[model samples]
Target chain A: MDQIMSNLGLLFEFPIVNLKIILDGVMIGSLFALAAYGLALVWGVMNVKNLAQGDFVIAGGYVSWFLVKTEWLQSLLGVSDNFVILLGVLVAFVVMGAIGWVCYKLIITKVIERDLFTSLLATFGLAIMMAQIMNLLFGSDTQSLKLEYDTLYFADGLIDLPIAKLIGVCMAAGLALAVVLFMKTSRMGQAIRATAQDSRAARVLGIDTEKVYAFTFSLNAAICGAAGAIIVMVWVIQPFYGITYSVRAFVIVTAAGLGNLPGVIAAGLGIGAAEQYGSHIFGIGYQQAIAVLLLLIILIYKLLRQRRLRQVLQ
Target chain B: MKLKFATLALAGVAVAALSSTASAADCDEIHLGSAISLTGKYATNGVHAKNGYEFAIKKIAENGGVKIGDKCYNFRVSYYDDESKGDRGATLAERLINQDGVQYMLGPYSSGLTKAIAPVTEKYQIPMVEAEGASRSLFNKGYKYLFAVLSTSEQYLASAITLAAEMATANGKDPSSVKVAVAVENDPFSLDIRAGVLEDAGKQGMKIVIDEKLPRDLSDMTAILTKVKLLKPDVLIVSGHSKGAATAVRQIGEQKISVPMVAITHCEAADVTGNFGEFAENILCSTQWAETLTYEDPIFGSAANYEKEFKAAYSEYASKKVPYQTAQASAAVYVFKDAFERAGSLDKEKVRDAIAATNLSTFYGDIKFSDSGNNIAKPMVLRQIQGGEYNVVAPSKFASHKLVWPRK
Candidate 1:
């Protein structure tokens, strides 16, 4: 009882500590939402759950790193470091998008014709393959890009934020906004949305469902690739780090449902905040556990909601 | 059948060439086997160990190998990839002994794998001296055939705590008033390090403000740093593997959580000094062996010589800094060679006895195992990553650089 009292006292006494954690969460949460948006896109349109989504993110990061390391951009185009970083992101998008297109043509199309379990297994195999390939190419070392941005401290140094993270968040937001606009205005965007609603109906309406599926998967890969590039700038990346990002994306998508952009962002921020608070209160050992626990709770809540809706209809 | 024939022909040609160079048939080869983590999570360190062992074997062979009872025998290593799994290590060690007919063994990468392989080596009555796997619990297992050359994991962060206490006294503050915040990975190695730090801190009468075990994935240290900021501990000690050390340094910079002193374990494995540079400066870390150490040997001449040779051999082996694991791994092989020479015969019991009664100094350190097969004679040195180089700053006897206190 005394322990509990002291714990509560500690909680109430240091509200600023909690606020600092929340701010950290908000920054990290934006990255999670960006990756989750990609996973949601593929799941909604292609009707195939990409188990290799995290590998795509890691691949994108390596692509960005490769471009930044190579001096071809500086010699050929005479660009600055920031311009090189921008070019790295663009190259990641193109390269991963091409790989995604090739993957769809080679493996994804065959798996899409099979059952969900088969598709899941296939993609899981692809995830393992991609991880090993990345390890072979890049070696198993944790890598990050060094950004020259200085940190920004506010409120008398209470809240500390790195400007590199701010740039990553801004790039993520800009890419997300550009994607949304493209979806709203582009001709291929209509085909993807129509195919997502009802593939057979879209086929009957001459929407070319096959092309939509391929484009959607490529687009998903490109988004994850861009997320990876930003993450390499902000956080560190290793060959085996893809699975954690995939889990977070899965959690956020499940919590927010499909196509709800605001809810995706909200769930991402909530998970981030909960993870920080959980690690703080329960100790840092429970940080990853909080994500798995949140996943379980969200799943149960969803099951309960479905049952309640059925009861109400009856 | 065709592939086997070709392989046999190639082997026969190689053997003929070896025989042409050798004068006697009795001096064929001396074989030692090991299960190393060549793949999986510990692959990076495992590759380093592999390279170290290979380099040591090459050096030994170049020096005309070991002389045993009027015959010279070339050293050979039969390594199996354990894939960084404990059960796999255990099973493979058994295979290396039973099926492969190997009499000697080298230890695997981590403490957990060492624990897994110990019983098998013990049951088979094979003497094994490993360079990695430094958990204190392994020494307490009462296994006679198992010997570890590396300093036990418990001593990893103990020196950091001692340094903090020393600095406190030097600064005209009571050592008892110095506060410590510890974040350790919840593994056997890191837990032992935590225990050592806590016990040492208790002896100094320093207060522990925050203590936390990191999760498996090792992400999100913001909360821990936030607490550190509010409480403002005198020293912040982080004990974990590469990922944990990286996370701590990365988040420390991200949060800008300042402390008077910071000491971390496994800095070389993480390449923290090289990767973080200025951010890692003045951060004291415990190392098993440093190139700057004055330890000397007959074959390698000195610690610096061994490092120079290793770099010259493997040019792409990044990090001009020699990790303690590589040096320790080479030392393990040297122990085998030393024991074989002392035993002077192809006898398992004799070699085992020689290893048990072993006391010698090598390029790595003064290696003399206690009754429990732990190297208690060699003390672990602490280094501060200064200007992207690991400068030895502790044990004043081995001090090559001055200690940076308060980390300003």
Candidate 2:
């Protein structure tokens, strides 16, 4: 209790510390928002809650890390290290998109028509398989790329921002913007949104609902892969680290509701900041616990809100 | 016809018994069992430890396997992947004893896994010589059947605290005025490390500014680092196995945390020097054994030779410095071999007694288990990553390089 109080006191004594925490939170939160946005799209369109969402992210990270480590690729490209790393994002996106399509055909397609529990269980199994396979391939070590970029420090170095993380956040924002625009303007995006609204109605109106489902699922995975590629440059990734991203995605999507892009982004940033604050006050041991608690709290709040709405109708 | 068939069956039994006796006279096999982490967070070090055991076993065989009463017995280990979970380790320990009929056992990777397996080994009266588990709590449990070849966890970073105090006094500051920060993972090993640091820091009357536990799936520790920046403590202590060490080094570099001293565990195991390069310089890493030590034995020769041979045998370790986890694991196997020979029997009771009375020297270190089952003859060494090389810098006696204080 005293440590918490003292930590809290430090924030008030140096208000700039708050900015540091929020900045760190927002930078990390943007990546979480990307993963959550993928989850929201999958859930909103296909109604298959992807329990393997985080594994997709980790697999993407490994893909990027492997590419960066390939000396032949580096020599063949004859480009700067930063450009090669950024190129990994594009590569991971397309690769994971193909993987996602394969998964949909092999596993997701089987579970799509089944009950919700079936999809959840199947994806959960997929998540475990993916984590284990990656562990076997990569030797179960935490891997990351060390970017040579400098950090921009401000406020007497109290608030420092790494150029690598800055680039990651910008890329994340750009990806989100591109995704939003595609969903708003593209013909396939309209068909996807139409299928998501009512699959039977779309099929009756001559839309290929099956194609829309595959494309939506693939797009979600591609988005997650790009986010993961960015994450490897900024942070570390391990075979077992996928579950953390999975839980965060669940939290963000649950809090924001499906089909709400702005809500998903806000909730992701909010949860990220809230976690930092909780860890700052309570200590870092409570970081995972804080994430889980926020999830519970959000669920309860939504339940209460729904009850009140039902009572009003009565 | 029935009488002829009975005679044939009797002849078959006699022939089988005679061949078995002949094979036993040639070379008998002593089966040992181990349930180590093979596919989880601890898999890296777990695989290293497994290779250590296998190497030691092969070396012993080449040195004319264990001879007890004019019979040569080769060691064959039955391994099961524990997946790095404590419950899984305990269940596998039971399976090894009850199902596989294994009489002797080898320890798992982490202290948590060791703690779980200790109870099962005790229940089954199995003689287990463990190498990887270092948590002080494991020793205090009074496990008669358990024997550890390495020093306890409390000793891992205790020397770091003493060094910090020594540096403070050299800087013309009162030892009590020194501020310390501790961040450890919330596991049996790291918690015990934290306990040791807190006790030592308390004895020195130093102020503990930041004490925190790292989360299990540790990817980032910037929250703790941000606090360290705010507090500006004299010494920062962290212990979270390999992942924690890697995360700390990466983030400390990015955050530009400039404490006077920063000490952590598992630098070599995590290969932080290789991964982070300049970022890993000047950091104190606690280790069980160093290859530069003068420890030698007939089987593995000197500690340095063991490194060379092990690397030659396991091509994966050719690029990185062999982690002490592997070295200690080989030492544990050596202890078992010595105990079995000294006992002059395959009886579990005799072997257990011999293990409890172990007092020998090996390539890893001198081994003499106290009544509490932890090796008391060996001392933990603290090494600093100087210019990407781990050079011993603490305890003065093992100092290969001077301590670089006030990490740049």
Candidate 3:
């Protein structure tokens, strides 16, 4: 308790510390928002809650890490190391999309329309399988790509921002923007949105609902993979680290209702900041606990709101 | 009917004679069992430890196996993946004992896993010679059947604390004026490491600027690092297994955390110097064994030879230094072999007594278990990573290189 109070006191004594905490939170939160956005898409369209969402992110990280480790690829491209590292994001995006399609055909298609619990169990199993397979293929060691970029320091270095993280955030924002534009203007995006609205109605209106579901699922996987790729450059990734990302993604998606991209982004950033503050004050041991607690608070709040709405109808 | 009966008896006698001759050619096997972390967080070191056990077993076999009275027996291990969870480890321990009927046991990877398995082994009266678990709590449990080849956890970073105080006094400053920061994982091994630091720091009357426990799935510790920056402590101590060491090195570099002295555990196991390059320079790492030590035995020749042969046998470790986790694990197996030979019997109680009375010298270190089952003869060494190589700098007697003060 004394440590917590003292830590809290430090924040007040030096308000600049708060800025540092928030910056760190927001930088990490952007990645959370990226993963959560993919979860939101899959849940909104397929009604299939992806428990393996974090594994997809980690697998994508491995994909990127592997590419960065390939000396031949860097030499063949005749590009700088940073450019090759960034290229991993594109490669992961495409590879994960294809893997996502395979997963849809093999597992998701079987679990689709078979109740929510069934999908959850299937995806949970998938998460374990993927984690183990990755562990086997790539040794269960934490891996990251060290970017040869400088950190921009501010406030006398109290608040320092790494160029890699800055690029990651920008790329995430760019990806989200591209996704939004695709949903707004593209014909396939229109079909996807239509199928998400009413699958039976879309099928009756000459749209292939099956194709839309597969595409949406694949797209979600691609988004998660790209996020994982960015994460590898900024942070670290391990075979088992996927569950933490999965938990954060679920928290963000739960707090922000399905199909609400803006809400998901806001919740992701908010939760990230909240967790950092919790850890800063309480200690880093409570980091995972804080993430789980936020999830519970959001669930209870939503439940209470629903109950009040039901009472009003009565 | 009489002719058929005679033929059957003759055939049975022939079979028995053939089986006895075959058994004479091949040595009898003494099956040992282990529940080590083959998957999950501890897998990296777990695999290393497993390899250590296997290497020792092969070496023992080539040394003509364990001779018991008039019989010779070779060691064969049945291993189950514990997945790095305590509860899962306990369950597998039970399976190894009850289902597999394994009477002798080898210890699991980390102190956490060993803590979980120790109780199960104790309940079944299985004698376990563990190498990886170094938590002081395990020794204090008064486990008669359990013996550890490695030094206890408190000793891991205590020398580093003493060194920090020595450096403070050397600079003509009071040791009491030193400020310390500690960040350790919230697991058995790391928490015990934290406790040791707290105790040592308290004894020195040094102010603790920051003391925090890292989360289990630890990725980022910028929050704590940020605090370290603000406080500017003289010494920073960090202990997590391989992942923690890797994360700390990477983040400390990225965050540009500048402290005079930064000490951590598991540097070799985490390959911090290989991964982080210059960023890992001057950091003190606590290790159970260093190959530079002139420890030797007949089976593995010498510590340096063990490293060479191990790298030859397991090419995966050719790129990096052979982790002490692997070296100590091999030592544990050697202790078991010596105990079995001393007992000269397959009786579990006799074997247990022999293990309790263990006093041997091997490539890893001197092995003399106290009544509490921890090796008391060996001292933990602190090595500084200088120029991408680990050089022992602490305890003065074991110092292969001078201490590089004030890491830059």
TM-score leader: 1
Q: Candidate 3 residues B221-258, lDDT tens each?
A: 99999899888999999998777888899888878888
Pairs of residues clashing in candidate 3: none
- Which structure is stronger by TM-score: 1 or 3? 1
At residue B171, give the lDDT of candidate 3: 98
Ranking by lDDT: 2, 3, 1
Each candidate's DockQ: 0.39, 0.54, 0.51
Q: Taking the tens digit of each residue's C-alpha lDDT, what string does model 2 give over B1-408?
A: 999999999999999988556543457899999999998778877998999999999888877788788888889999999999999999999999999999999999988899999999999999999999887888877789999999898888988889999998899988899999999999878888888889999999999999999988888888899999999999999998778999999999988999888899878667898788888989999889888877899999998899999999999989877888899999988998899999999999999999999999999888998998999998888899898888988877767789998899
Best by DockQ: 2
Over the full model, what C-alpha lDDT does candidate 1 score relative to the true structure? 0.85
The reply for model 1, stretches above 4 Å from the true place, is: A1-11, A78-80, B1-31, B35-47, B50-101, B309-322, B337-347
Please write out the lDDT profile of model 1 over residues A190-247, one tens digit for every residue. 7888888899999999888889999999998999898888887777788888898899
Superposed on all Cα atoms, model 3 deviates from the true structure by an RMSD in Å of 7.3
Give candidate 3 misplaced runs (Cα > 4 Å).
A303-314, B1-128, B296-302, B309-320, B333-362
Error (Å) of candidate 3 at residue B96 is 9.8
Clashes of 1: 0
